[model samples]
Target: MIRKIIHIDMDAFYASVEQLDFPELKGKPIAVGGGGDRGVVAAASYEARKFGVRSAMSGVLARKNCPELIFVKPRFQRYKEISQQIRTIFYEYTDYVEPLSLDEAFLDVTQNKMGNPSATLIAEEIRNKIWNQTQLTASAGISINKFLAKIASDFNKPNGQKTIKPAEILPFLESLEIKKFFGIGKKTADKMYHLGIFTGSDLKSKSQDFLEKHFGRSGLDYYHIVRGIHNSPVRPNRTIKSIGTERTFEENLSSEIFILEKLEYIVEDLSFRLKKQNVAGKTITLKIKYSDFVQQTRSHTVPYYLSDKELLLDIARNLLFQSKLKESVRLIGVSVSNLNSDQKKKPIAVQLRFDF
Candidate 1:
């Protein structure tokens, strides 16, 4: 059956929230994050984006890009409250909702509560309702599957919706740039370019075996998605695979002592996150990035689940000393994986009421 999927994404969620709460911030370039030299941007408003400011950029660089950029500290609790309110609206339409983040989600409305036959109309209604209730704008993509829906959502962004009907799927994929495909990153797209695969049509020309030899397991996914074949469902109860934190330092440090000092703080942050989520993991990983941009990781899996700060710090310290520093380190991170919450759950299949 041809499934009806809708991908909904909020426009500059964190930055927009800031603008909504503070009217004075509206129409002004704003970044939601610390303004300090060592801080990073959590989100950038559309105004700031025009100046090439973006999320994950250093505050210093963001300021350099937009001299008038106003920085506000992030309020995660307030964001979560608003996220919950938006989620409640989603639940009113369909039980099959998969949230990608606090700002974006996918919904399988093939069998909606409203008994709506046209997914396009449903997407329009949802966008209108969201704006009416929250005074926030959303963009939507409606298509036969999640892959196409996700790609479509970005076509007409900010406060618009697009529907890719069955007839348009093939031509749409053929003309699409490899970089615009959902899972293809910049590095992968570059690799594809060197292999003469610049567009979906070029990608389709390659055999599955040839793709697998280069991209390994992801090759099959690439082959299928370019043909509009993605069966991954919208799982409402997605499990948390891991929870961790990391920090990029303002200055590079060559000393192990300084790295250990940084790890202590990271351990504390990771511990707080684990405890808040009521989950623990046996595997702890130490991620190190050198001044020259080379990255490495060292991991140790304990026999039992651990979440204590002291224990995590101890493990991180051991991992740090286990290997010699390649060069002065610019970033240090600690993460917990193999989580207790990582138990596999069966995906909830959609029982289609109609076929497209």
Candidate 2:
């Protein structure tokens, strides 16, 4: 039995939401984030993307890429509200929905409540419902498994759908560029190119042992995914492993006094997140990124759970002063792990008939 998975991804979610709410922003290149020298692009509208503006790019560079790009502060609360509304539409079709983030998810509608057999039609209907309710467009991909579905979803993006029938899977995978595989990043792709693995067919030609020798444990994943074999199921209830927050400064700090000042706000933000989730952790970790891009972390575990801002700040301060400053620091982060929440039970996978 084969599973029918549909991957639904909202088109430039944050930027799109901004454009939807502000008519003036429509048909323009816009970025959703701070516009200052220290600011980072959280998301870029389609128009901005064409000019090489992208999420995580520095605002300075984004501006250089497209000077006319308008920057808007992010409204996370509003995005969450809209995300929830979109999720409700998904639940109407299937219960096996695994959310990747606020704007994308995977749904196993092999046995949908609507008694619908065609995952493609269900995807189309779901996209339609989202547009009708939120005035937002979503792209979807339907295939026999999550890996294929996820890649297919991006084939025709920003209000489009694609279906990869079982018979077409092998040919599609063979023709796909190695870099286009979901988990293969630039560095990995470069390494693969050096190894003559330029396409999925090239990747599929390598033996598991050869791949493992070169790429270690991840090599096995590459071998299987290249052949369109991904067995990971759609887990609807993913565990919250940690709650944290971080800030990158426009200017690096050289003194402990200035670093501590930044830690105060970082700890406060982490506390708010932990409290919002009604979860606390016994371990607190501090992350430091130097101006040169070198990173380090210091963690301390307490006997009792902690979520209060004062307590987190105390731990963060200790972690910070635990060692002398290596160099000018560019970013600082605080995270709490080892939460007290109960682990969710794993659902048993059911073999279902595929109609795609």
The models' CA-based lDDT, in order, is 0.88, 0.88
Q: Candidates' TM-scores? A: 0.81, 0.80
CA lDDT, candidate 1, residue 163: 95
Off by over 4 Å in 2: 243-283, 286-297, 300-321, 324-355
Cα lDDT of candidate 1 equals: 0.88
Prediction 2 TM-score vs. true: 0.80
At residue 199, candidate 1 shows an lDDT of 96
Task: Pick the lDDT winner.
Answer: 2
Residues 1-356, candidate 1: write the lDDT tens digits: 68899999999988999999999999999998767765667788999999999876778899999999999977767777888888889988999999877888999899999988899999999889889989999999999888999999999988999999999999999999999999998779999999999999999999999999999999999999999998887787788788889888879999877777677767866775675456799999999999999999999999999988889989899999896788999998899999897477855655453596
Over 103-183, each residue of candidate 2 has an lDDT whose tens digit, in order, gives: 899999989999998898999999999999999999999998889999999999989999998889899999999888888
Off by over 4 Å in 1: 243-283, 287-318, 325-334, 338-353
Q: TM-score winner among the candidates? A: 1
RMSD of each candidate relative to the true structure: 4.9, 5.1
